[model samples]
Target: MTADNALPDCVALRIGLAARALPDTTPAELVRVLIAVLGQPLTEAKLNTLKVKDLKTGANGALSEIDDMAALRQALQCLHGEDDTAAQAAVPTPQPDAEGRLPNSIQVACASNSGERLDGHFGSCARFLIYQVSATEARLVAVRPAPATTRLSIDHSAERVKLIDDCDLLCVLSIGGPAAARVVNSGIHPFKRSQPEDVALLLGDLQTMLAGKPPPWLAKRLGRATGERPPQPSEVAS
Candidate 1:
């Protein structure tokens, strides 16, 4: 049996969303997982009741459904009627000041396949989502697609760097060592994350750091002279 009769497109759409959320999972594999966990033809009501723990405990794959909690939550949320496309559309922006900047804000670039998510790798992300973030606010300033090419190679790293050169930082799930070197050489700090998450959530964490005694790297990014900030507690003598 198929999802044709279930929840008026709910099962199918939710499946697509869940699959998208777990970038590492193919729809066929997810369907198998659903079949095992939810039994036979999945329904919207059944999908709605899906939980992160269910997948984590029931499914096994490259991501293992255990390692990527952020992804699991997103997938479950998608199944639970949380619309990622709608969330992407609802991502709001903060108005910039006359100078086209937010107060004490810095430009940040996120590698993403989806519109406002930090779910893509540096070398292969479809687009870059640029945001202006300060202690109090964050704004989605631009969405720049990668320069189209016949094929992607290390040489394209420089092109990608130039694409977001105006940004202060670049965050991605993965980046080649050479590409990271190039990014640093271009004055853009490259941050590598272990998992994909919402761009807004990532920016919110940055905002919180900005409101406190930020770390050396962050303080440097915020224009504080390197020597002016105190060392992290862990760095001090035992």
Candidate 2:
């Protein structure tokens, strides 16, 4: 298989593991796993362009031809099975905020195309909606347009990362492996959602997580923000 048709061993392993561990894994979740593993943007168009045989070879002899999204979903389902009830039950219940405030508020950058929803992928978003979030509330801080040139040049991914360097978290429809790594390396957290969602709803969820005992990842984010100095824009390349 050509390099482009090859799936990295790490990605294949992850897909296999996720299929087994989360037997009820949904297509959206599978896509998230794929994007996270590849560390690059993945679109339906890109996926459809890949041949089934090529994908099978790349998957280390694990997968067959997935000609379309439906086929891809079926392939993922065949790897395991789905249980919607269990999946829904797995979600944590929201808890009330102790003091309606966090030790420190965090800034999040949401990738957006229309400015109304979190509908854009990290690499292609028209702008980022910045929000300052606390345990009880989230407030809009800024709407920063994406750098025009960065999208045209892959090498400028770092420049794109710089645009949201000040944010504690980045929420997007999707993000590639390399860009996600760059974001993490810069001390920012990355989150992927399945589809376009209301920005307000996402903020509410953040608030809920803060109000409750956050997961280890989120707790670490909160802790990190307490001691770290806010990154300066000048520190990033123009």
User: How accurate locally, in lDDT, is each candidate?
Assistant: 0.68, 0.58
Identify the candidate with maximal lDDT. 1
Model 2 agreement with the true structure over 48-154: per-residue lDDT tens digits: 34433443444343333333455455344433323222222221123344554445788888977564578667765557888778897676767776653212223
User: Candidate 2 — which pairs collide?
Assistant: 7-58, 39-176, 39-177, 39-178, 40-176, 40-177, 52-65
Q: Give the alpha carbon lDDT tens digit for every residue of 3-102 in model 1.
A: 3233245565566557656654544456667767778567777887777767865545424534767778877887788775643443334354457777
Any idea what lDDT model 2 has? 0.58
TM-score of each: 0.55, 0.53
Superposed model 1: Cα runs more than 4 Å off: 1-99, 152-154, 224-238
Clashes within 3 Å, all models in order: 0, 7
